[model samples]
Target: MKLLSVNVSKPKTIAYDGKSVTSGIFKESVAGRVMVRKLNLEGDGQADLTVHGGVDKAVYVYDLASYHYWERELGRADLAYGQFGENLTVEGLPDDQVHIGDVFRIGEALLEVSQPRVPCFKLEIKMEMPGFSRQFLASGRLGFYFRVLEEGMVGAGDTIERVKPGPEQMSVRETAHLLYFDYDNLDRLHRALRIPALSQGWRDAFAELIGTSEGAPKKPRAAARAWQGFRTFVVDKKVPESRDITSFYIIPEDRVPLPVYLPGQYLTFKLAIPGWPRPVIRTYSLSDGPCHEGYYRVTIKREPPPVDPSIASGSHYFHDQVEPGARLSVAAPRGDFYLDPAEETPVVLLSGGVGLTPMISMLNAIVHVGKTRPVWFVHGTRNGLHHAMCKHMRQLAAENDNVRVHICYSRPRPDDIKGLDYDSSGHVSVKLLKRLLPNREMDFFLCGPPPFMKSLFQDLRAWGVPEGRIRYELFGPASLLTEGTRIPLRKPKPASGAADFEVVFLKSGVTARWDPDYDNLLDFAEDQGIFPEFDCRSGICQTCMHELLEGEVDYVVEPLDPPYPGRVLLCCARPRTDLVIDV
Candidate 1:
């Protein structure tokens, strides 16, 4: 192994997207010997210390082979040794071959591989290619970052020798691929987590992957459902909770004792309207506690007119068409966001507008346990008129000394008295939370509109709340979130214990087994090396929709907004039979 060039550069400001941007991704080859410091190379500095220039990422190393490949791939002859902003450009260390935690001796400096280099927008600017960062990461040519073990000075043409290899069986590309692409490999995640030299950020990311499994004991799979695929639910009563929100009490026709579900879980309903050819499915949060008084309750707000009026709103169908004693096919309660009623820690149920549905359930369940775990039920709406179940929430707080409810009205009505109707006249924010709550020891559970969810999430993070303590149920993709970035989750495995199936990707020409371990076709397809574009894997988005050429499939998650005609939302679908799909 040999060093072709040692590059160094300081942070520089540049204009991008009509704003000033600063980055240190522009390095120039240094002529002579350079000092390798604990945090960075001499004369090299990063603009951001939060994500860059840490002791673990002191040096960035890129292989010459990747540069050569990119030169041919981009049809550009202007590629340079330090084009990737690497402090070390070497010939022998391939991204796929170098294992994270591997120690190497280069000249007088000793270093160990910490983690794979994730390309930021700065890389796209450096390459003068838009969307190149995604392409670079997906290509698995992302070079690795290094932790300087011993700082020393050496220059170009220095021989590199391996001191020790990473004990884990994952390369730089493998670790990145495990995180970004092949994320479902729990075995690999655990393996990567075992490496002590792995960066703390990567370690935390891996820990979050298994967070749910490591938390409170979950109900067994067999005990979770009271009935199979879809059960007949008869609406015993439908009452308006507020001017805009209504609650429906549903019970099985046979009057079976419904299984007690975790609080904050949602119920999926399949509506077979007279005019519709197929069942229209929608998911709504359970508003009542998990005591299951022979019935399950769902609170819903009537949806306003959608941009496309051709498609009827599911909530509208529930409010206008569905009546008392109406029969509906409802799936059993499910969702990872649900909270076990037995938790002893301080819990915060935060919500905005109609988002209070799940919070109501959570609050009711905690009160049912009568545990003095310090519960805070905080909610916000436009006014008392817009707030649903205000009396019910207040009653719960009044009844339980451990529970405290704080109401916020962004724009309160004239009749809305501060003491009676609301406690605050502003939005529910971290500022209000800090004043209302005792401390940061509480675990926050938030469900709200995008803006409300995003702001509060970012605020809590900025206030030093741990990521695991701030839980949320987002209607859209978490990727669109600016701060407190969270990874979207899917069922770890297919809920069905049915036999394995086959799925064919027509465009990719790959016919592969639909492993029983895969929750949906998207993960199965990805395992087969057919990665289709996707967002909001919960089926809210149609990004993963594709044409189903042949065979039938069942939706593991029914998209409230259905995909166009024959196209299937691969993220939430599982093949019922041998299937062929146009990628």
Candidate 2:
């Protein structure tokens, strides 16, 4: 087999992992000979050395024959060489025929086959396809990695000749298949363990799997996993639910089944915009039921920019710029706020404005599951003009005998009729809630803007609702929760001697006293004009992760995903003691 193309690329900065990342996936075929080195091609670079770029995975090669299959599968004839982020596009040497430790000579370079490529999100970013990683693994056409045995110049049309086959009987295809699908086949796994050419990462994985296996690999604990980064999704359709709200129907471009998600969970999107230095990350609630097939829907409101310009705004982009056929980078559905299907207690879904998104998900899930428990979907908005999904909500309520729908419009338009358009004409308060439902024993799930959430949360407490039964989700900046719940509306007189901790920003040469009203270190730092990079102040994004040089911090709430060992997410952590941090 001959090399069809020699590709190389320098790390190119792109928006990834909720921050700006330099990736080497945008490789281009070099016209002439390129120097092949022990670690990587002369011009090539890997952004994260921990995952890519090592002697064991110095070069990535794909068989040119697979391009034909992909061209047909993707229905595009314009697929080019180096499109799969391959360093060497060869005419032959598919995974099934390439065994671990097999040595080959191409041009003047001697290289050894190391392992099959374990696909990552970079593949998704390179191909602009969501679910590509899973699909690639399932296809069994995985390419093999090569470690240069002799550094030499190689170029297109170099003939690849097998010099010597190693003693290992395990082929690249066999190893990957065993690792991915036939994981439970301990006999084959044990055989693979003997292969000397297996990559260290895969070897460690296999070792761990074997250690954890009692005839079968144990299920991975959820807490131990990190976000798999963004996957590409296509907007199949956009349905206008109301004047201000529209629902985007997204489905995997690879046609894979949607990941299992509970009702009320949200899908976080990493939106790439040309002018923005970093991709804007935003979370939108899944508006459809989990039982819905072929697609997942997220309802979004077109939020107008606030009078203050500093606040981030992506609603305008979603409503105006994004359209059908737009490719979107979407994370898996995730959120702590969700309805428990196992619960038998009555459910009360309360919302104001677009907070109804999650409520709709919970309601649809209950209806789809044919749950017989009582459900109340109560919402308040400006009027009929601003109300969204009313028809669908009414239909579900009508179909389900145990479900009730209540719409309270604070202001009615001139043409709006009382009974037909709205059930009430005032803001939904404790008195109004009592009058409508009269039962305080139901599980209350609240979501809305700060004012709505704060008022309802306090009113619920005052009306004797159990704290455990009352759940709420604020739209943004979770620090609002601390402000709404902990800090009193009126300023309190200073205590005789309240202990204050010192927070020293070593880089900026600034220090600030930790005040009780400060929600977190990030907040306090921002106030002191030392704004560290931050996104998703709720602690989902690790953009604000800084090294804790000489300090201790306590989290206001445990983060969804923990930071790296020596780093702390300032967004959620408060200075527990006088500390120094490397921002």
Instruction: Tell me the whole-model lDDT of each prediction, alpha carbons only.
Output: 0.80, 0.78
Candidate 2 residue 438 Cα shift, in angstroms, is 3.8
Candidate 1 residue-wise lDDT, 17-110, digit = tens: 5678898989999999999999999999999887788988999999999999998898999988789889899999998889999999998999
Please report the candidate that would top lDDT against the real structure.
1
Per-candidate TM vs. native?
Answer: 0.52, 0.55
Write down the worst ten-residue block by lDDT for model 1: 216-225
**Candidate 2, number of clashes:** 0
**In model 1, which regions exceed 4 Å deviation?**
1-225, 483-536, 539-569, 572-581
Model 2 TM-score?
A: 0.55
**lDDT tens per residue, model 2, 475-572:** 45544544546533324445223437777888999977777677778877876888788766767767889999887778875665678887889888
Candidate with maximal TM-score: 2
RMSD vs true structure, all candidates: 26.2, 11.0
Q: What is the Cα-based lDDT of residue 16 in candidate 2?
A: 62
